[model samples]
Target chain A: MNVEFINPFLTSLLNVMSTMASMELEPGKPALKTDPIAKGDVSGLIGMVGPQTKGSLSITFERELILTTMQKMLGEEHEEIDDEVTDLVGEITNMVTGGAKNILSDKGYEFEMATPMVVTGKDHTISHKAKGKKIIMPFSSEFGTAFIEICFEH
Target chain B: MNVEFINPFLTSLLNVMSTMASMELEPGKPALKTDPIAKGDVSGLIGMVGPQTKGSLSITFERELILTTMQKMLGEEHEEIDDEVTDLVGEITNMVTGGAKNILSDKGYEFEMATPMVVTGKDHTISHKAKGKKIIMPFSSEFGTAFIEICFEH
Candidate 1:
């Protein structure tokens, strides 16, 4: 994976969490994802198609982090996953992907993004559309960990 | 839900299974999907973006059907979740969606399709991208059931 292609998404994820949910995320390391099972309880996934390249981006959130972030962003504490939680996660996924899409567009990688899908369940599965090594970037915060998986073929 | 928009997919699914894998599918009554938990062991999901409406289509197959279909299609059998199964499921997802896409395109609904994503696990979860009621069109075959989830915002 090229840093030029991937750095924008990492920066975008950090920025989205900070600005939207007031959650600061410290990125740990980038690794190749060998397993298809999700790392967290809930995930939002979006696919991207460009003139030359196409791929997918997904962000998985721990249960505690998702619930706690909901309290901060919506000012309401929710006990379980509902339309509200799914909506918030969907927005977060859209914002992160949209932010990176802009930078990539400016760099001449014009692309179109699909609507994001949100899934909530213990040990849920997510598989990217792109064919290649999918990279998992882990981030730590006060709540727990956020995993961003990116796959792009070049 | 408009039958005009969804009938193509149902017909295409039956045709795809019958022609591609020599499996005949009997579609059951269409109903709204209230549960996010997947109905089977493996699923393939694809998203669509169009001029007016956008949504997703997913095809899930039971383990026996997947294995049996693989045996018929590839002349191989005996497997847990593996690359071959996922690839075949992905191709089925693509073909079924593509078949309907062509019919829908002829009907004047131009759509750009995202590449399909394959997920395999016991009791997995699947969430569609579009808003509004998600419809599950179930089909029965010799092996087991195959569920087709369709959601499009109108």
Candidate 2:
């Protein structure tokens, strides 16, 4: 596994989130949360593949956190989160991937990205076909908490 | 605008296509010869947003090209392109964004990427919304041709 592939992306994401959104993410011991946050929850995901391995990365957040994040991003208060808010989250994933891509290019990795798809509703789980490894990096902010999961197989 | 944000991604995609398969891409030009090939058409897309801009990246290819590429990646020739082939294309986009993200991180741009959606069809057009700038880089291969379109407002 190319651990170098993951480090730059993780660092870039931390810098973007902290500096641009004024949000703080403390890296916790690797673990997946046990409790469900309820259904109709929206989460952002990005997937990656290279000459050696392939996998997906996802950032899951609670509904309230997403709403508040949007509020801050748009610079206005909101009483309710709608389709526009969903679109906002999808775009957020795009920016994170964009930031990570830049770092990966310097390391000599080349690939293309797909348009984002917004998943809604509850009772859904994301499954990866990779049989090699999966790493989950959990994080939290003043607005809310989220997790980044990286799964890949060579 | 940030042409840097878009150029490397296009280049990386060209590299992936050329390296993974025997497809020859004529950069900056559309396909000169149309070949009738049997394969599914798959498209993957991701969106991006920030304090300064918002946009999306879309990559589309013929089904045969996707299957041949995956066969080359895995070093096995598959009789058909199934879920695995689609997943491979999605992962390719994931890799592309991962590379792009690193570059944008240095520029102080923060972003997140959404889950990839695979749309299958014979012939279709994918569109995005951007009020400011739009760029399209088209490449051709023996199996087929695909293009990357970046549209955003800064």
Candidate 3:
């Protein structure tokens, strides 16, 4: 796992959250996660592949943060996990990944991204489609907490 | 969605079931699915990327069939959906997609496959990463029924 490949996601996550949701976030120390069980109640995951590398990007968001972020971004009040929450999560995943994709492309790691999927459940498991180090970047904000997972195989 | 690209998945699915799990599968009519909710209790999904094309492949299996298939393949009895069931489903997804990948690559559609993800839950939603028509091929046997979903973007 190259630190070069991971910085883009953390940077992009910060960019997306502050710019998109007007929430400033501080990134906690990134760590390797061996378990597939999700830490949040809702998640959005997408796959990435290029000629030189293949990987996956995902955001597992706690319910409170998701609801608050949704309120900030979409002006909707969501009480529970529903279609709108998942849909919004999917869009957030796309934007976050897209931001990273551009930064990576500028660095010569050109790849195409797949559609994002949103999974919602307590104790849900997300098996990433990439075989490599599963690194998680946990972020904290005034709203709540969220995690960004990136699996890069170079 | 061209039937040309879809046949490989169905063919690979039947072949994988027969050769890998010793279950004979009869593929039903392939149809378009707009809904994201999965029909079965568990599912495995993978994404595909190439210079010219991008898509995703997935398999959703009934609990009964998964347990039975595990019994036949691993000679272990599993009455519940746990780590073993999800792990086996991930392997099946890999083999099925690998078979399809070879067929597609031989036809000059060279691409790379991402690792497969196993998702377990009743009515869980699987978001395909590719933006295109989603075609689902249903297969039935004495064991039970499973679905192969292929989303191809050209």
Task: Give me the runs in candidate 1 sitting further than 4 Å from their true place.
Answer: A34-38, B34-38
- Give the poorly placed runs of model 3, Cα more than 4 Å off: A79-82, A142-144
User: How would you encode candidate 2's per-residue C-alpha lDDT over A31-113 as one tens digit per residue?
Assistant: 43232222225656555545554555656666677777776667656555455765676677667767777888877875444
What shift in Å separates residue B6 of candidate 3 from its native position after superposition?
A: 1.3
How much is B131 displaced in model 1, in angstroms? 2.7
| Candidate 1 local lDDT, A110-152, one digit each (tens) | 7777777776667656777567778888899889888999888
Q: Candidate 3 - CAPRI tier?
A: medium
Candidate 2 overall Cα lDDT vs. reference? 0.59
Candidate 1 TM-score over all chains jointly? 0.90
**What TM-score describes the B chain of model 3?**
0.94
Model 2 misplaced regions, further than 4 Å: A31-40, B1-154
TM-score for all models, in order of appearance? 0.90, 0.48, 0.88
What DockQ, on C-alphas, does every prediction get?
Answer: 0.51, 0.06, 0.52
lDDT of model 3, residue B38? 57
